[model samples]
Target: MQITVNKTGGFAGVNQRLGPVETSSLDSGVADQVRRIVTESDFFHLPEDLQGAPVYDGFHYAVQVLDGTAEHTVILAGMSDDPVVARLHELIHLLDEAVGFQWI
Candidate 1:
């Protein structure tokens, strides 16, 4: 999986860069988990309800599952306070790159 980090404006703005993550090379473990989640998740369900302390004070998350695609997105603040959460987020993005929503 190639995690591309694109740096946006800095020294003036918040240095926000919504980099693109391509998840092509997926290990068996991650691949299996993602497949299971996709199958089990409520496709008819509404957007996940996230109610808690915001990951980023001003930033909001916008996640989308590509239509007719298997790629699922969980957009949250850049990173989470917990390392595990951050890692999981990146891992999901990698899944997005690997098996897109098409295969689903």
Candidate 2:
């Protein structure tokens, strides 16, 4: 499995890309964390587009997950109130920390 995260449109307007990282390449704990987050967020069940209205100076996130023949993509606005969005944000932040980028 592979997961990719692209973050854009923050207050600094800086765009960041983190991984097409394979789950097997990560530490066992990190891989488990990623799996738990994906499962808890129900990421595969979410719509492909999740941009809610939009907010000034808010960030935009694009997450893609590939598991064998299945692939899911979700685009979200930073300030969305949805629980899924909140979970995604948290997952992205965790990934950023793991990868040594503070773009979130």
Candidate 3:
């Protein structure tokens, strides 16, 4: 599986992007965790447009996931306590750690 995260609309209005990273290249444990989440998540079935917190000057995330021939892209404008957001947050965190990027 491959994952990519693009963050925009933060306080500084900066644009940041991370990966087309392959889970196979990650540490065994981290990769496993990511794969498990994707497997158990409704990620693949989510709407392409997703609303999150909607905070002013907050961040927006464009998270794209690809597995085999399946691909999905979800964009969150702001953040919320929604389970999907939480799951994406966790996934982003793992990706952040994997690539040495910070999301907050």
- What is candidate 2's CA lDDT for residue 29? 91
lDDT of 1 by residue, 6-88 (tens): 22222333333332333334677765654444445532253443323543344433344443344444434443465433444
Q: How many clashes show up in model 1?
A: 6
Count clashing pairs, candidate 2: 0
Ranking by lDDT: 3, 2, 1
**Per-residue alpha-carbon lDDT of model 3 for 63-87, expressed as tens digits?**
9999999999998877576777778
Give the TM-score of each candidate.
Answer: 0.35, 0.85, 0.89
As for TM-score, the candidate ahead, 2 or 3, is: 3
In terms of TM-score, the best-performing candidate is 3
True-structure RMSD, every candidate: 8.4, 2.4, 2.5
- Tens digits of per-residue lDDT for model 2 on 1-104? 79898878868896878887788988889889888989988888999988987688887778999998989999988456788887888778777877744444
Colliding pairs, model 3: 52-79, 53-78, 53-79, 53-80
Winning candidate number (lDDT): 3
Worst 10 residues of 1 by lDDT: 1-10
Worst 10 residues of 2 by lDDT: 95-104
Q: Compared to the true structure, candidate 1 yields what TM-score?
A: 0.35
